[model samples]
Structure formats: C-alpha cells, structure tokens
Target: MSIADRVRVHSVETLSDNHYTLRRATFDFRRNDGRWQRQVRESFDRGDAAAILLFDPDRRTVVLVRQFRFPAFSNGHDALLLEVPAGMLDAAAPAARIRTEVEEETGFRVSGVEPVFQAFSSPGAVTERVHCFVGRYRPADRHGPGGGHAAEGEDIEVLEPSIEDALAMLRDGGIRDSKTIMLLQHAALHLFPGAVATPGK
Candidate 1:
C-alpha cells in the first residue's frame, strides 16, 4: 500500500519556528504485518534549495566557495567548508535560483545552466530538496567579487580548483557538503567522462 493509504496523522506540534521550522508530528502507521502503531517524529523544514557546479571546460576547472557553516562547525568541522555555490530558493524557480546563487557566491555570472537532478540532503529529519545543475563560465564571466550578502552575515571566499583536484578532495575527505559532492560526482560521470576511475583500479 502507498504511504498515504497506510498512515494517518494525529496531530502536529510546533517545536520551534523562529529561524527555520521544527515540528513534532504524531501519526498512526500500518506495518506490513497488518499492525498499526503510533509514532512521533520531528521534522526540520528550512525550505528547498538550489546548487550549481560551475565549470570551465577549457580550463578543466570548477568554481567553488568556502564559507562557515554553524551546523558543520558544531559537528566538529571547525574550519570553513569547501562547496559549490548553492542557496535557498525562497520562492524562485530552481534554475533561476541557482543562476543567481552561482553569481552571488562565486562572482561568475553563468549565461546558462543545464539542470542535472534534485535530491534531499537529509530525508529522515529535514524536509529539504535541493535542485542541482551544471553551468559553464570563463574568466571573463566574472563581474564582481562574490562574498555573499553582508546583510545575511555570509562570509564566502571563492576557489577555483581543477576537476581532478576536486575529485581528489572527494576521495581525501576535504569536500564534505552533500550537494557539492553529488554535483561533482555527476560532472565526473557525464560532463567529463573518465574523470573518476573505479576504486582500486
């Protein structure tokens, strides 16, 4: 049976809603064994987001950014994390949102973006789906010094690393952002074939 057919929501309680949103929901779930059980789950919803992997095919490089994330820092990652340009949609379409994010976070205003896929970063507790894409740019495409919005307290530093080095960072535990990892892997497989090899090959 489908999830909607097998479950019923009892009540939803707001746990927190100041910054993002956190809610506790109680529901009745029917198991495959034909038993119904009461369950309580908390969900964190911060809205959907969009991320783009900006690449320079001729240069074989990818544009990235380094920024401080409180969650990552609280989880023992104290240093700034490296990741592709990404931002919350906040009502904009995925492709349009990502295009703005790429320029805002990397200073490279890409003319177009080829969408790849969309995925949830953490499904168990977070209700967030990220739209992903791959866009191309050259040195001349950079029009501004991107450091994110000062009003939002975003302090971002741009980085340009070769595709080989980026994948290597994926192997070496340097790149930890989930969206960034997914985008880079997609590029390796489709954008630039043979960019990544089979493990232990």
Candidate 2:
C-alpha cells in the first residue's frame, strides 16, 4: 500500500479480564496501483522494554546467561535456556535500561552501548517491543561474573565464551534464545568474521 491513515478503533479485553489489550480499527489508504486499501493493525497494552546482547571485544567473547525459564520448560524445552543479558525497561530509556542490565546481569560496567535494533518479541498476543543493543567489555571488567538471584525468582549464571566458541555453540543449538541468536548473528556478520580477538582488554 502507498499509505494508510488510521480511523477510529476500540478494544475489548476478555481473557485477561483487565490486562488483555486490543485494537479494532479501519484505515484510509491507497495501493500503489491507485486502488483504495486499508490496513488493520492489532496491539496489546504494554510498556516499552529493552534487551542487551553483550560482547567483550577485548576478549573476543559474548556474555551469556542460563536460568530456569518456567515458561519455556512448561512449553517442553528440556533445560531452561541460554540467553543474552536482558530485562524490562522499567520506564527507563532503552539505552539506560540496557546499561543497567549489563551491569546487573554480567557485572560488566557498561562502557559503550550501541543501539543495534528494535524487535517485536511476539505479535500474536503480546505488546512487547524489545530495544536491542550491544555493550562492549574488556578483560579488566571481568573482575567477576555477577547477576541476580533474588526472591523475585531470578537465578542466573554468567558466562564469557570466546567468539569462536560462541559461534560453535550457536551452530550446535546451544544459543537458542531468540534475542541471543539475533545478537550472535549481528556479531558474526559485523564484529567477528574470519578471526576473533579482544580489542581493548
């Protein structure tokens, strides 16, 4: 379609009773060939969120975390999962949230955070827009691998795997988290290609 102008829309929540978001709408638009067209988009009620896929350039590695993902387990995954350093936005800007996530999850003081892309985690029923980014780290920063494991039910283990090793893990089905996979793919294409080396540390 050439363009679409949103008309009036409304929502009715049933399943959630109070939390399910909905959008019913009509659009005013035209097709490329001059025919009128309409676009209907549905959305859920959710605030913004952020996810950070961390890479240690100086060590040529990316920090990965493993945790008990109840949802995935109930969905039939054997183990919980392999995932990137990620978290909710909490009303913080994507960049700021990412930096905080890196520190809290990996103990790598966020040095340089580069906006990678924004992703829609799911479109079927969730209104989650993931702001993805990359944070650079070095050997000096790995004084320890830190993360959260509080009563809120967060138990995490941080890992710094070589870029080559990380790729191998990706190929072997180890890096399965959707967001983590995307981050690794980005690093493979842009950060590490023929060789892997730490840059600063």
Candidate 3:
C-alpha cells in the first residue's frame, strides 16, 4: 500500500500561536508487517522561508549579512551569525520574496535568481521548508545602505567577501549557519566550478 493508504491523522492540538504556531499531532500508522501503531509528535509551524546567495562572478565576491540571533545565543552559540539574505515567505512566492530580501538585507538588488533546492531545516520538530536560490549581482546593484527595517527591529551588517575567503571560512569554522553554508557550497560547485574539494579527500 502507498503511504497515504497506510497512515491516518487523528487530531492536532495547538500549543501556541504568537509569532508562529506550535502544534501536537496524533496519528496512526500501519507497519510493513501489518501491525498498526499510534504516535504523537510536536512541531513548530513558523511557515516556509526563502534564502539567496548573491555573487559577483566578475569580481569573485559574495554578499552576506550579519545579525544577532537570540535563539543561537540561548543555545550556546555566538549570537551574531553571518548568513545569506533570507526571510519568511509569509504567503509571498519564494523567488519574489528572496529578491526583495536580498535588497532589504544586503542593499544589493538582484535579478534573475536561479533556484537551487528546497529543504527542511528541522524536519523532526519544525515545519519550515526553506527555498534556496543563487543570483548574480554587481557593485552597481547597491542602491542603499540596507540594514533591514527599523520597524521590525532589524540591525544588520552587510558583508562582501571574496568567494575564496568565504570557502575558507567554511573550512575554518568561521561560517556556522547551515543555509549560508549550503548556498556557499553551491556557489563553489556551480558558480566557481571545481574550486572546492570534497570534505574528506
């Protein structure tokens, strides 16, 4: 039987609903050997998000952002994180949202974003599926000093580092954010083409 035929959802209980929604789910599943099992799981429903890596191929440089992340600090990580420009979809299309976010977060307006992939950030506990992209940019694209919106309490620092240096940061533990790392690695593989070696050998 297909997965849909083998599983059933019982009920969902909302635990919170402030910035995002949290819910506990109850379900029943059929085992491969024909036994049925029941299960309950809790998940966060912050909605999907989009992220983009902006690169200047002519100059071999990339644009990134640094912002204070309270969650990271609470979890024993350095609060300031360097990452690609990103934001929650909040009902906007992934490509459209990322284009706006790139400008709002990095001061760089980018066009012609190429979609890379979509991934779940924390599948076991969070229902956030991130849409990823890579886009081309140039120095002329800077139209403002983008530090995010003051109304949203965003104080961001834009960073432009050479592509090589970014890869080095990935290797040396300077860049620790997951989406940032994924996008940079994509740039190294497709944009730079054979510049980065595989991790083990």
Error of 3 at 179 (Å): 0.8
Clashing pairs in 1: none
Residue 174 displacement (Å), model 1: 1.0
lDDT of every predicted structure (CA atoms): 0.90, 0.74, 0.90
- Model 2 alpha-carbon miss at residue 143, Å: 6.1
Candidate 1 shows a clash count of 0
lDDT of 1 at 142: 96
Candidate 3 clash pair list: none
Each model's total of backbone clashes: 0, 3, 0
Better of 2 and 3 by TM-score: 3
Query: What is the alpha-carbon lDDT of model 2 when measured against the actual structure?
Result: 0.74
Higher-scoring candidate on lDDT, 1 or 2 = 1
List the candidate 3 regions with Cα displacement exceeding 4 Å: 196-201
TM-score of 3: 0.94
> Which scores greater on TM-score, model 1 or model 2?
1
True-structure RMSD for candidate 3: 2.8
